[model samples]
Target: MTAPDPTTAIDPVTAAVIQGALETIAVEMGHKLMRMSHSSIIRESEDFGAALTDPTGSQLCECRMSTPLQSGPIPGYVRHILKVVAGRGDAIRPGDVIMHNDPYGGASHGPDVAFCVPVFHQDALVGFSVTTAHHLDIGALTPGSCGIVDAVDTYAEGLQFKAIKVYEAGRRVDPVWQILEANLRAPQLVVGDMEAQIMAARIGAARFSELIETWGLAAITAAHDDLIAYSERLMREAIRALPDGEYRAVTHLDGYLDDPDPGRRDLPLVVTLRIAADTLEVDLTGTAPQLPDKPINMPFEGTVDCAIWLTVRSILLDSVTFGHIPQNAGLTRQIRIVAPKGCLANPDFPAPVIARFCPGNQLADTVMKALAQVAPDRVSAGIGNLRVASFSGLKDGRHWVHMEILEGSYGGRQGLDGMDAVDTLYANTRNNPIEDIEMHLPLRVTRYELREDAVAPGRWRGGIGTVREFTFLSDGGFSMEGDGHSHRPWGHDGGADGLTASVTLVPADGAPRALVSKIPYLKAKAGDRLVCLGPCGGGYGDPLARDPEAVLHDLREGLLGPEAAFADYGVAAMPAGLDEAATRAERGRRIVSPPS
Candidate 1:
């Protein structure tokens, strides 16, 4: 007997039904993980993703709430797992669950644990169900297994698992769980989260099996093939619409550990995009060399995934087009990536990657900027990068790790103002609620509000970042991992640049002191206050051309100060309304000789 040809086209109605059913399974898997997880990071912030893939590890569908960064890499992660198991001559069974967190083994980072289970129909492997979530503790130098800026290599980062089986034949592997538990600070939470992932994978596999049983394997496989082909066609059509040309842009990371002043050193990331007919390619040949001691390096496969995501988001923003296009391997049919070896984006082995999010976000921003040269109306200005801060310590003889993702402003687009105090790009994880933080850890929320006057003024004003301050209830240490400190977010079309990010530590009886953007650790006593100020987003269009009414509204809302209104927008701060004549005179004067 021979296998049925997958190229046989299925009815469009059946194909759409199967596609929707697969997507629902992925969503249910994520909901299961969230409901059963022990960590607040997974339950509250929702830092997880779930997906379904074919037997060869090609993604079929993903959960709607999954992070783009995580979902993009699911296929690669699954392929890596299959290869590893094949080398050992191990047979993957329906009840088996595989787990890994090694960055070199196709994971996003050490903290993001991935679990995959083989979905079988009639004792034959048909597909895989996958789930990935950020665990709070992974036995790293820090509590959250991240924000380590000074780590020299992967050994200091955390415990790494390279494609190991955590369950077999529907039974938990006690030894594997024991070894993981022995190394983690919060063993109970870690094991609980791992079990939650396993449960999610199981749910996914079971649901997929039911679909196969109901519809038969031949029809389902045909539908899968048709869906992938349809998406590839759509992606190619989208790419063909762009003019054939080369677009290039450059951006920089703020700090390196080896420099005399880490803040003063700038690491460049250059991107060149080539579009021809129906294909697009991104080359990162001249990017900065990998840092030996800093934790800013990213894995090559993860970097490629980030590039693919940016391209999809930029070209397919419409609901009708995006809805029909499958979020799978087909999306990459028209994209090619060239990342040079040993660059920061594709670093060599042994380099620390706990802080890779900084460079990853910058890569996405750089690609958008390059595309903006040709599609100015379709692209937005630069956005403030993600700033992750972690607070951890021992309390009541138990360890507590509180990792918070501070929200940054997004750049304003052609006709729309940027979103205010929100997560941008790859760092779209939700902000941890103040009440949740206070209830779970030894900290008090002091301030949580938008930074005033931090937005860049333009025709469409950029969004402002937020300020989050915390007072310690007990002695603990804090670690900062992010970028966008020395360099400001760039504005487009003659708009003004946005503000940079900063951290301030104020003692109870002493003055405030500035801290570096990336810190291995900073000890603080009870009653000390730590404030995290996020960077603002860049604006779109000229600030001088901003409407007086918009400027006045900003004034009333406290986002734009009186001084900034007069200096950037040439608008007078009047008691009742704008001084129309004074505004006209100021605009005319500026038009004669624009401020350089």
Candidate 2:
């Protein structure tokens, strides 16, 4: 007998084909999650990501819809499961589906639920399938999965399923159901959502196994290895394109630990990404201090995971031409991330991190700035901040939890303007439909329209912001916390800063009032209304570079306001032929040196 050559086992072409198949399978896996999920967060809001991994737990391929926010943690989560299973001296038999939510246990965010299932071939563990979904209710002390800050420990956050086997050998465990029901407020929905996650993992595992069988394990493994290497190469090429140098940027948060407060001035977070030929290094040594008492504190490891994924997602989402680049461990072969211990990104276990994105978003902005130092044409000015809106109250005498999240505008890039009212780089979830929300719950959506006069004016105007108003049909009860209202999204180059976010409350009798940046809890009564808005993305270039006709078209199409058409853009809305000449003359007369 002679040893076989790996190349002979699986050619690179076949391996590439298998990789494509796995990518498609990942999308199907997500569809299963959407169909089976119970909460609006996972189903209607589409806040979940799915991926395929090797038996030892390395990410191979994922879906585009998974978004930039979720790519970092799946592999880490799988590694944790493998460690736990190996330490127990027990084999991961088929049907041994385990779930973990502890942010310390490899979760990107607390609400993101990770489901792991091991695939077995010939009575041996061949590979693993992992799925993570943002579950709305984890039986937390708060109404939704946003954990309560008042709780003394994790128990108050919700039921903890620590490496607990929810399903065993392809069968649902009885005790698991009892335990889940005992903790979660919406027992039926929570358990149903979990089942949906299991179904997704099962589909992924089955499809992966079929590929391995058809192509043989050797061929499949070779493809996996080749794809990983190819991804690393492509990323290195991208890195090498940038001149070897150090680039730095910094961002701030409204506040880390305060509820119903504007937040302490600004919580600074500095980002420094070094590109040296084919390698990149990201350091967060000067980041802000972790909030010892706030729910915004997340394990530093989770932060590192999120940041890396954010960078990759931004690059890919910004351009489809970059799709050829594989997003596996190889892509980060030249990347090194450092976050000082006890900082916001990496902290001790059980640190309250319900609002991880507050600082996380800042980290992303800083990273973009660092990238822009070298690749200005490749990056866009900051856009409206992204936030998940939480709404929970009493319905029909029972406690109910509902959350509505929004994706605001993104600033334009070098050539094109940013997209409007869309999910930023961090998340790719959908907005819950007004009809779905009103019909299923006791709330009414009075006004859900784009907020005018919210765009940052420039040669190419930034994307417009959005405004939403909700009327409470039942008693008042709910609270919210998010960013971008106080610290507006900054424009790059010559673009101006976007509008600040706003939230207002219309009382049954009293005048409407402005809302604080973050809210832990607020008492409510029937007929009270809640309105929230998102900021606009920043703009690029001098306002003079914009086309006058484009500005008029925006006015005609409702994308731009009349005031913007005249003031920021310098386009006059005059009457017909004379108007065009007058507009030009007016623009010429007002010409002055650009702002310093």
Candidate 3:
């Protein structure tokens, strides 16, 4: 593990001030990108992250709007770019920006477009501002990068751009633009969004240079070093808080429907976390074999790094005693990863990985579950996996795709219940507004409402799930992909399980049709509708321990219906015409649970 010199110190006030300035710049960069970008993912879903990196490629800070995953592997990505550029460490000139999407070559998932812009001062490279946004259309083999789940190679996944300069000497590279534009379905939109990325990088570079001007080069560099050191120290302290031992965990993925190989069953991902004196090691040695035909493999290092961040963040946020560890590269110093070759985490060439996030989130879940054994009070039950439902086809002679990324509820904790209708982990983005969807695409939200009695029953009831129904204006097709249906979100500490997710389509026929995990291309005529119900959160504690008054409150708010009140919380409702005294008498006759 890298260590910061103990002799060096930064004033608390100065550190806070620098952090605030960097945060402000990050927010501004995001705003600039969103304002200029043409992609719906950028302007609406906001499926991107931004950060400022030191000259050495180390992440200095991430903005509040940015995600921890975005900052985790950026240093790796930068180093990979340098290697591909023929060891030209200093060749990255001022006003030049590089872009790449080689996941195997140390980038994020296939659809996440990344750019690194070098900052120069006095003709010397000072730092690099990196930004990555999820492009809705990246000229993939399949439209919107959906389908092609049975792909056999990276080429089938999408086009791969090696580490190349997209901008040089403040001018956009003509050849790069021509090639990208020629291959994409929406050429103008792609080029426009790429330009937006360049602008965002420029914004970050200018802000960073301004900071240097305000606080001489020496002071800024010292501050950067101090920040890294402080983060490492705090992370080590957090590690010390955990018991020293080896803990093993494992999670399974819903097998791909397109895999021709019949021998493979549901893919199981194994994760082992070793907590030592000052370091935490995550090993994926015993993980399942890589699937050459399924789109679920991930770069080993990226997965391990992201999993560690999620687990550590959950502990800090949920713990009674949290630490001050900075969410930057310094936190990574105390964490080590080992992903053996040919495993799901470290697949070889030709492994389809368009849907790597499935196993990635599962890996995080397994690690967190293992950590919960040692720190039960600080951890909650499992959350419903990310549900990515997409609708795509030609609408009014123009091709479009609409994705409803549902953020299901989180698991409940020892003292409190889990959050509902919100994904609390990686890609905590919002659902695209119905208004935006209808206006941009050929779909309308027919019905959007909360699912009734769809929560897991417990003393502390699990969160209720939600449902979204959509109808098509044209006879387009739809597809749904996700997990946590066959396997509901699991509870902990004698808690109850959460409800599983379900999807159904309403036709202009006899009855609503139910769909499976992986839906093929199904044509939806006009007046036809699709309904999606996301999973509920797992419950914490015994159901009988919940207060009756709380149950009544949930009943009043309509979060819990009468059936759930009686079945899950063991609370019966009073008669409609009963007075308070009569209701109390009736309650006294039926309330048999202990004090909560």
Best by lDDT: 1
Candidate 3 is scored at a TM of: 0.90
**lDDT tens readout by residue for model 2, 1-596:** 12236555666677778888889889899888888888887788777778988776778788667755554678777777777767888667887898876677777666677788887777877777878877667877677775243444444556665566788887878987887777776666777888899889989999988877887776767777877777777777888877988878877777733455444447777788887878888887888776655666655555556765566445633446665656687776677888887777776656567667546665776788678778887777886777666667665665567877766787867777777887776666688898889887878989888777666766667887777788888874676657776677778888887777777888998999887667666777789988888788888877766778867777766776666677777787632312577568768877876999
lDDT tens per residue, model 1, 331-366? 677788888888888888988787887788888888
User: Candidates sorted by TM-score, descending order?
Assistant: 1, 2, 3
**Which pairs clash (backbone N, Cα, C closer than 3 Å) in model 1?**
none
Model 3: per-residue lDDT, tens digit, 49-156? 777877777777665665545556677677777778866554777778999778877676676667999888888877788788766566765566543344676777
Which 10-residue span in candidate 3 carries the lowest summed lDDT? 574-583
Worst 10-residue lDDT window, candidate 1: 312-321
Q: Point to the candidate with the largest TM-score.
A: 1
Instruction: Name the weakest run of 10 consecutive residues (lDDT summed) in model 2.
Output: 147-156
Two-way lDDT contest, 1 vs 2, winner: 1
- lDDT, candidate 1, equals 0.82
lDDT of each: 0.82, 0.73, 0.72
Give per-model TM-scores. 0.95, 0.93, 0.90
Better of 2 and 3 by TM-score: 2
